[model samples]
Target: MSRMRYFTKVEFYNYRADSGGEKAGYYALIFFFYNALIIYLFGLLMYKTDFLERARLYYSNEHLFKLAIYSPIFILELAPLLFLLRSKKENLQSIGLTTSNTAISILLGIVGAIPFTYQIILDFILHKKEIQLEGANLWVEFLILFIFTALPEELMFRGYIQTRITGLIKNKYLAIVVVGLLFALMHIPFQMSMVNMTFMDYLITNWVYMIQLMVMHIYFVYLYTRNNNILVPIISHTLIDYIQLYIK
Candidate 1:
């Protein structure tokens, strides 16, 4: 038996295939169907799981803030939904139904970092807000958050549901608007759980944030068009998140 290599080209290719189990539009429908199933199953399970308890060992006002702040932004929830999008790899290379590029990923990451840092600094200078230094294990939580959460969520929503449904409509901007709205609604559970917000609150609060979120989604679309690389968006998203966390 041969020892497994830490990082190999062949292994990377294999993992990429596994990232997208089927063709873009193929899993998109599955994600749409399975998504509801996943919600029912997971929702039922979470309701019974330790996570169901409102008053737990970790419960607090701070935890409320944690929930409200992190839930929609989690991004990983989209993973299960990736089954719903289009693949761009064929436009790039052999069997290249899709490809994940790293260089542009790094560029967007670096770009997103500077502005985030600047915002943090501005907050500090004006003494209007402050970022608490909460102790966290970067590599560990990041793995749990991004790998287990964000990437999958992005794959499912932006990738799966959008592409599949949009294919029928044939209107690009409308497709994004439709999917983005659904993406926002998908977080309703968290919205309901984390805070006592009304319909107006949900719409109003998100309207401001949605602008940035939509822009990020567009950037991912651009990356998809250029390199057929979902990874670029994934990595860009992950790094941008970490940078945001650090800056705050």
Candidate 2:
């Protein structure tokens, strides 16, 4: 093959369409571990460097810092995968993204967000405390949340991780559960930051919330799997985050 064709070949990534389920299962393990290591290393680096503390001290720069922290997912996961797909002349739909039913997808997102929003409202009413909004403009914050946070995350978890695992396992429901757990585990750093307790104490106290987040992950995964469209999960995920930002 020519040099250009070399990289564009779908087989270049080692994902064979005819591979046995056992092979796919092995690939899933490798993919999960690679992503987990990268994400954990990024989190550890931030902690060691006290980036979160700096963001708190220089509250005006918090948004910038947040972007800096989240950049790793793009650099390590999303970008590479996207490049490989593009090289293959593959659209996102090759990995289960579709827009044939855009209206229904959007409506599903809105409907799914209702209960989550209600829970947030209930928590605010009970606690009489809200998340602190760090930015000057709600619109700007919304864009940041959707672009930097929601887009990358959905692409990583639902688009790449869950899709790959499901394809590998040949069991959509089981893949959702597995990916959901991973999603919740990935929130550990954020959870620790939000709570003032010691690490162990925080984990203990937040166990219930973590379970809730895991279930929510399943909901988002289901949205994606149901329609084979990532946009729904992205919209639903972003809506939930936007509500959190608004309340803060």
**Candidates' TM-scores?**
0.57, 0.70
Best by lDDT: 2
lDDT of 2 by residue, 1-248 (tens): 22121111132222333533344445555656676676656666556567667656655565676666666656786666676457555567755456577988888877777777888878788988665665456766777777777777787776666645644555556667887887877777644544434557877878998899789887876676556667787888888888876784
Candidate 2 lDDT trough over 10 residues, lowest sum? 1-10
Off by over 4 Å in 1: 1-100, 103-118, 121-133, 198-201
Score residue 89 of candidate 2 by CA lDDT.
59
Report lDDT per candidate: 0.49, 0.65
Give lDDT tens digits, candidate 1, residues 49-75: 565564344555544545543464343
